[model samples]
Target: MPSYPGGETEKAAYDLATKGEKLVMDYLNISIFDVQEMPIDLYLFFMREAYIHGNMRTKEGREYLENCRRMEQTKPDRKKIRKKIQEQKREG
Candidate 1:
């Protein structure tokens, strides 16, 4: 099978760029505002690459991929998963 670029490259690049910025911020005390746009443009490049050669395993797979794409586009923040504890309180 042809090795296709994974469809999550934009998210991956975002993650990488964030890490890079974080490193610079932590170590060099540089501001993200100083070099902000290159990563964003690189993100678009990643998207285009994925669009051209994303792996579509099945129709359902394609749908799932698109859903993830939308999610990344929106940067959908997820609520923390907290476990609910059962309380045994008896009222007299």
Candidate 2:
């Protein structure tokens, strides 16, 4: 699961995910379940496309984008984490 930044809660994540899912479904004429089955990269592409072309200048859109940015910032750097783990193992 993706992590949320400071001041972001699970509720906020839920709201964003549901709203984004709805937007994708309406834009693509697909169902929520269909979206659930989409690859993460494809789903993100559609989400970004929707944000760019779907008139996201409104207050809600701005908030959604802000939340998206926060969520993105919280994604762990796997390479850095792995390097740390390896260094620890070598030292021990």
Candidate 3:
């Protein structure tokens, strides 16, 4: 089976400049005036942080899904376990 590397790239997309700007703006949760008031360095710092957090979230999501897939492929045959479902765990 061919394996595909998952998750999106964090590289800035010049073609989506407007959308990127909007993302940064929304990430900061501040008004346009506040954004303009920030220094270039500060703005860049926040934008970098936004992308970092977005990438981390995507990475975690992918890992969770991959784990789920692996578990599905390897689960024990339920019928082989004689224990009643209600007696299986500590909920009692």
TM-score for each prediction?
A: 0.22, 0.43, 0.43
Weakest ten-residue segment in model 1 by summed lDDT: 80-89
Between candidates 1 and 3, the TM-score winner = 3
- Can you tell me which runs of candidate 2 are displaced by over 4 Å? 1-17, 56-92
Find the 10 residues in a row with the least total lDDT in model 2: 1-10
* Better structure of 1 and 2 per TM-score: 2
Who wins the lDDT comparison?
2
- Name the runs in model 1 displaced over 4 angstroms: 1-55, 75-92
Candidates sorted by lDDT, best first: 2, 3, 1
Q: What is the lDDT of residue 64 in candidate 2?
A: 58
- Model 3, position 9, has a per-residue lDDT of 34
The C-alpha local distance difference test score for the whole of candidate 3 amounts to 0.62
User: Tens digits of per-residue lDDT for model 2 on 1-92?
Assistant: 22235534335333453877877888899999999999989998887677555646677556656666667775787999999999999999
- Report the Cα lDDT for candidate 1: 0.46
Q: How do the residues 1-92 of candidate 1 rate in per-residue lDDT, one tens digit apiece?
A: 11234533344333453644454444434466743544767544544444424447467557656666665554433432122222222321
Query: Which RMSD values do the candidates have, in order?
Result: 15.8, 10.5, 11.4
Comparing candidate 1 with candidate 2, which one achieves the higher lDDT?
2
Model 3 CA lDDT for position 11: 61
